[model samples]
Target: MVFIQKGNNPLLAVKAFVQGIGLLGNPKLRKFVLIPVLINFLVYGVAFALGYLYLADIIDQFIPGWLQWLRWILWPLFFISFFIAGFFTFTVLANLIAAPFYGMLSAAALALLSGESATITEAPWPKVIKAELNRAAYLGSRAIPLVILSIIPGINVLAPVLWALFGAWGMALEYLAYPLENAGILFSEQRKLIGGVRWGALSFGGLAAAGLALPLINIIVAPAAVIAATIYVREIETDNAR
Candidate 1:
């Protein structure tokens, strides 16, 4: 079935991304993706530091006259922020860490399913995997600078949209590259394939964010997002090839 329908359902798209990650292998590749993802961690760390230094006092001022009651309310809010932030920080980190392995695994799985094992054995495992990961990382990392820039005066207002779109594109790149590689397609080909079903992918990508959205489920969000992406990629390949 063509899972990437013309309709734009954000939840479905995210669900698909989570499914994609389940198809992944290679512990080493997962570790490799972590390096770039740590860059994101560092960025978030700076945000935390700044918030503590500059915003904590401002938050205290808003606590009102009921110090006892106010403390209870503000305490939860403060803790929640840390929890939510850490959750998303790591989910993105996982995607950044797992892209290369996902790419190779996607290619291998599709090739085997396509009755092309003979040729699959000749696949350039290292070159293709690394290239795909690098491209995905490049696209994913585009959001980092935007995030930093968003803190600037005028640009801070635009942060939400820019961050969301950058995030969507990053998810699209990382998720789509695997199936494209599995089918022996290049980055350009993968882009075209995803472009054809852009809305669907975006929808799924958004849904994948839900796991990262809530603090409790965030623990599973990273692997879940990867699995969803794998499923979506496989569906896209199956639909187009048929």
Candidate 2:
């Protein structure tokens, strides 16, 4: 977890950005990233298959006939929409599936952030899996509104903004789960602690959200976020200890 000095939102964001990219140097981090990468592939696979079907439905049912003539326009727009839809829609989906497996990754990242070697637990595999899925779902469920908003018309334009805003907020809490959970902080306490430097936390999240909304780079968003969130929270605690 990385925290910037007070009022240094820019550095907070920059550190997170650098930390995520800097993760490439740690071969250990690569192992953690691959599981989520596989999850992204799996989630996007289903979304891709349904991509056309969802697009046609959105244009035909949600879109007005006046816009029908603009299939070329609508096609590309909806394609982008699919990406947005993919962002919110598949994020939770991906988290639910990957969270269990990624918990150790999250924990490892947290240990790495603190300059400590990650240690394995004696806990059984099934229990660990169950705990991770539950943690991911606890956070993922909160984003249901974002998922719904993505499908709704008129207000859908606002979805991107909401995605950028709340998406950052959500990712902060969601990805920070491992470290926070390790510290025995629940969602409510997590929010309160994060609220101390709200802008900084959101800035951290907003950066990840920006990458998430983009093509190609979007796939790395989750793993990157988990790593980023670990650095972020740990930094904040480190600063406070001074």
Candidate 3:
């Protein structure tokens, strides 16, 4: 009975995310959710360990000797920037690896929400791979500029905030792509549809991004996000049909 009325309500995104988490306990979705959770657990564990070990060294290389005095201020900013960047970078990699499983999960979730049969055909892998590459390219085109900005002294102050916002948007688009793609929505059309409901997308993405940063909770966030995105997209399509 988890449902959302379609509109621009940003809060709808929050509700959808919660509903997704709730739905995880449903007997119907548990199987679909398991593999993605395992994938995320492995990816997240490695990313966290690597970040803990090498992130400071990476940050040091970015700051020049003359900027040593600014370490107190810059350290925090760079840490936030790197953390966000690294998180999303690894997230993209994880998603690429899990795309097929995610497609099946999306299909099942979509079927559940739409009250249709849960059985799904094997996802078209070629289309799924193409869609993932398109998303990676789209995110990279923007990420490069943000990475460049994060190293510049004066302007770098804004890098953390900017990176955070971009991360949220990218995540929203990333998760939404699965269900949309399953529905045979093209990448271009997906962007347009998400753009039409930007606020809700951002909020949902922001919450998901924030959740992923948490330790134990992050293991489940990916699959939940997939479900949430499915719910969000389903509601939007329903509204359009009205």
Candidate 4:
């Protein structure tokens, strides 16, 4: 991961995501990345099942009889809309499930950045889990309003954009937490670092935002996003150094 850009370039920020995918070539990174990927897979597998088996049926109930004439057009659009909306819903929920492990993953990703072997010292699970749960709760609470708006007919129209932007911002915050935390940077400082290169942050977020909307890709996106965000942070620091 060469420093792709010195300044906050939106396109470079977006490219950071691609760089993340490239980083998986490390092979060792794959071992650690799988933890989050599998966790997300199992949780989302059940979610996909439930959505396929029940959610659509429930949503179909909301379609009025008068709209039956437009079933072909409306149903596809609705399902597609729901699929995209599910990206945010599922990403938020999956992150909550995997939060306990993210710090470890983020730390590992950071280590990998240094060309160091990602030998993670086992953390105290109880304490770590508690902290993660609290963090997830905070993030969850922030996400709830957007999740609710996604279901309401009038407001759901805006749900995609709102949820995408919100989810991406959360991605920036969550993935960067471990590396930044390690550096003794607090949230205020984290915000400043990210805010300085706002477009870079959003571009990183945007790729993540788009990834969440994808199908199979969504499964692997979180860890990749974390790795990408780590690289992004390092690039910021490197750029500052120069």
Residue 78, model 4, lDDT: 60
lDDT of 2 at 124: 50
**Candidate 4 lDDT, tens digit per residue, 32-68?**
7777889888877877787878867866876688877
Segments of candidate 2 deviating more than 4 angstroms:
1-8, 66-86, 122-159
| Cα-based lDDT for every prediction | 0.53, 0.66, 0.86, 0.68
As for lDDT, the candidate ahead, 2 or 3, is 3
Query: Model 1: what TM-score?
Result: 0.54
Ranking by TM-score: 3, 4, 2, 1
Task: List residue ranges in candidate 4 displaced over 4 A.
Answer: 1-7, 63-85, 116-119, 124-135, 142-144, 147-155, 186-189
Report the Cα lDDT for residue 103, model 1.
Answer: 51
Stronger candidate by lDDT (2 vs 4): 4
Candidate 4 lDDT for residue 69? 80
Writing each residue's lDDT as its tens digit, candidate 3 over 1-242 gives 11234546887888889999989978788988898889998999999999999999999888889989999999889889999999999899889888898888888888888788867766778877888999999999999999999988889999988988998899988998888777777888878778877888889999989998898799899899999988887776776676
TM-score of each: 0.54, 0.75, 0.94, 0.76
As for model 4, its CA RMSD to the true structure in angstroms is 4.0
Q: Give the lDDT of residue 75 in candidate 2.
A: 53
Best by TM-score: 3
Which consecutive 10 residues in model 2 have the weakest lDDT in total? Answer: 1-10
Decreasing lDDT order of the candidates: 3, 4, 2, 1
lDDT of 2 by residue, 60-135 (tens): 5645667667656445544455555456656767776777655666678777766788683423566545555664
Candidate 3 regions off by >4 Å?
Answer: 1-6
